[model samples]
Target: MDRHDELAARFEARRGRLRAIAHRMLGSARDADDAVQEAWLRLSRAGGAGIGNLTAWLTTVVSRVCLDMLRARTAHPEEPYGDDLPERAAGAGPEEEAVLADSVGLALLVVLETPSPAERVAVVLHDLFGVPFDRVAAITDRSLPAAKKLASRARHKVRGTPAVPAAEQDRHREVVEAFLAAARGGDLDALLGLLAEDVVRRADPATLPPGVAAELRGARAVAEGTVLLRERARFAAPALVDGRVGLVVAPRGQLRYVLRVTVEGDRVTAYEVVAGPARLRGLKLAVLDVPAADWAPDAPEGSPSSW
Candidate 1:
């Protein structure tokens, strides 16, 4: 790769961290993605200036971007903070099955909305992501003391909020992966077992494959339809869909569909698939580099047994 490619790769490397920062800062994945994209555009416009501390520079740029968004969001009360995991998935694009990852919980994110825009930026950057308070001050356009105070107040609220534990998040991932493995093997019983008795499958009109139901209810009905998901199932991999563990179907590097599901105990209660162009484009759907322990690696394209 040449200079441009190198810079892009480096930027991509920071995409998740930047998105995580933006997610907490803005409290909306859609808005968070918008902030990250805006930062990239600004970076590209600069023509790769020879700046030391690229990560810090990019972080500052994105923080400013999110700060502006939070201000706009405040001005327009119509755009509320985040929703539950399922609602977030329904509204979220085909990015990660678990869109939020382990960054912060939806409850805490809702609490973040209580903070002022500058306070949210300062707290998320300095406290959560560990940026120094001085740089946070620069990003928030506040004096050092003012910045510290903003973060201090936000931190107080955060301390009182409850967060989902890492272990529970891992359990969520396990159920999602089990569903994927069962789907891949066409294991009807396994599929039924993992699905709730009154499970529901909702899909965008364009996402339904031929003979597939636009909406399905009950485990048996959903499982019967799911075994037919063989073609896409083989390409499916675990992702952080709207901050909860979910699955995405991407044969190579392109996103075909995103399955955002709700899990209760070991059973999936509800889920939606987003595949329409307009919907997909709005999501954060880059190929996730999930570790091997997460799922069996995708086989080579066109190879036997690979989608």
Candidate 2:
């Protein structure tokens, strides 16, 4: 094969890993897909010559693209989930480490969303990918110590007790499953039993329309919101959200409304529901149809099982 063909082969091999990283970093699968495509375009033009680490190079490219997108995203606003909103992956194969670093769970991704572009690059590279400060410095165009500090700051902001243990996560899963069953069956009390006394359900402010930014607090409000959603929106399959049980809701005749549920102890404590055409693109979900059974609690990890 010619050098171009050879280079194309190499780039294709790394697409999955690169896309996974971009998805984690961008928080939108569609954006990640775009970033990966852009990275390949760059690689094709440059040719695959004299590259010390092809994986790292592609990761850097993808990160840069995502960073640019994030910069532009700041200008536009998002929407809130409908009043009827439901409360709702790993490994790079070698050369895959750079992209696989921090792309694990929803909690980590949400935490990552709070940092500036530079801080995200720093923390994700050093803390998650094990990349040295010097290399992170290069990628972020900052001094080594400055890069270290940025990562430190980001880490501090997101620091918390260790995540709920895996076994505990399983238990949470059971509770969430029961809650879903009850909600789908229109059992109000059964659904409320799965929520904490102080449960809070807030729509994604970025996606909600004006005059629709609503926050449902307390178990009663949450339970009420659940009923509203069940009566209105349809759901795609259930996907494991942040390593816990969760599902995605796509409203009838609407292209958005992705809900992710966070279960604490035996009750639901947090609900993150996002709605917007752009954000929904990355979710790879149907426009108005409820997701398939594949999105249920037992679906494979990282599947578009839930929002």
Best by lDDT: 1
| Model 1 lDDT tens row, 54-86 | 678888899898788778767874421111122
Cα RMSD for candidates in order = 12.0, 11.5
TM-score of candidate 1 to 2 decimals = 0.49
Off by over 4 Å in 2: 75-105, 160-307
Candidate 1 lDDT score relative to the true structure: 0.66
lDDT of 2 at 95: 26
Best candidate, TM-score:
2
The TM-score of candidate 2 is 0.55
Model 1 clash tally, residue pairs: 16
Error of 1 at 225 (Å): 23
